[model samples]
Target: MTASFAAPRYIVDGGTEATSVLRRLARAGWTTREGFALPENTWDVSGTRLVLFGRVADADTAELAVLAAARGAGVVAIADAGSDVGRALYADLARVGPVSVDPDAPVAGESDEPASSGPQLAPEQRALLERLAGGETIAAAAAAEFLSLRTANRRIAEAREVLGVRTTREAVLAYLRIRRETREG
Candidate 1:
């Protein structure tokens, strides 16, 4: 008999959050990344067991919907702390499955924490970051990580939001700026 391994799961807050995570992972050299938004109806059928619901405005509602949709889906819910609702939501969702938060996550007015800080990384997020750090192409990163091109774009958007920048290029620059500052400090 052969055993099958399930993909890692995630539940990011929104499109922007998703993008930020993807970009960070790509730059960090992770591979085989896959994630999804926490859309109530559509995600259950997204095929992958691991799903990411990026930057949900209403954590309570999103949590309930995720719990409902994940009934038989076995999806892991990941939250971005940039949204105030995330803390409470993480606690509640943790009862059902693994729940994680990103303190450096960019919502609107998130803290000054590093994007790498906060809760443990979900399986998918960890893999994505590894490949990104390894210098994988955005498309290759997405494909190697099992994510769709659309989802890859969303992840890039998330990175931009975290850096308070509008585009991936800018976000990359911002990340570099921090690295340089740290090195010279």
Candidate 2:
């Protein structure tokens, strides 16, 4: 996947403030990184990266100006009107190391190809469906085998196809019919 530029950082001091900022950013079509702001504290960190800081106090703005120059480092700090840590964070980031911004990559997960070509059910899958019909929740069945909910749903869907049914209720009835026939035989 192609890389998109870094999103701006926002560290508000409260939920209402954060929501307001996010709303404004959304209206402007600016994307955001995930982070939360608490009362008296604001954090705009994302995925192990600290982006920026802001404050309501600060007589001088030179410290902030210098940090802005290092914007390309993918990190920045601004001390609020009278905050000491803001200056310390800027100083620490300035000398501690270099920050290189890399493009975001796509997440790799299980491919969505059909598990198999046709409507065949393994013995394990059949038993799972039976248990589900016997009052077991899908979550329980899935957890018992460590399979994902989607995988379990897929297995049940495959069973429905094999039994020529359109719904799980029909699938259960069909399965029961087949079982009764086999027992009599």
Candidate 3:
């Protein structure tokens, strides 16, 4: 069997305490990327895990954080120290509110709680989505995946649930959006 591994999740932040934190993280073997300096108090984190930075800016930044998390890129916001504001920020990233993390906690995390917050498509779901995107009919897509029509519908239903959509078209669009985001990254 072939093995597949995900892309590295990145950690980025800025603050007075950030330099030490970044150093600690680097020493811990986490991948680090550059962004706002610590005193600037801005964090731009992305990868395939649970992390985020909130509104030092606006909705666009928040949306991007959410998208990154949804795409499975980690988004731990070390700059904010998981405060009231930080919990609030994580809540926004989670889209559910009141999500909390210990400020002093060592930075290993992944959120399996919220569906939309970190939805990952199963391989079959992805195949179906890709097939649909390619304009294949459901029966043809089912054949392509070697699944029965009923099983295919079930798979599509699961994808729709994970993507927080009510329709197959929206699921396809959401999957496509995820594909684009990961590719861009």
Compare the candidates by TM-score and give the number of the best one. 3
How well does candidate 2 score on lDDT at residue 28? Answer: 43
Off by over 4 Å in 3: 1-117
The TM-score values for the models, in the order shown, are 0.33, 0.34, 0.39
lDDT tens string, model 3, 1-185?
A: 01122322222244534454445445544565542222223232233222223233344454555455544444444435344544344444433111223333343332224333346766568889999999999899999877789878988988899899999999999999998887776
True lDDT of residue 60, candidate 2: 45
lDDT of 2 by residue, 1-185 (tens): 01133333332334455445444444444433342222233232222222332342342443443343233212222234135644444333323222211111111121343333333344445666777778788788877755678776776777787777898777777776666666776
Error of 1 at 105 (Å): 12
Ranking by lDDT: 3, 1, 2
Steric collisions counted per model: 48, 5, 13
- Per-residue error at 75 for model 3, in Å? 28
Per-residue lDDT of candidate 1, residues 1-185 (tens digit): 01132222335655565566555443433232233234465533324333333334475566654564344233334455455666555444533333334523332112345444323333333344446556776788789865777666565655555556786556555655655565676
lDDT of 1 at 141: 78
lDDT (C-alpha) at residue 86 in model 2: 43
* Candidate 1 vs 2: which has more lDDT: 1
Instruction: State the weakest 10-residue window (summed lDDT) of model 1.
Output: 1-10
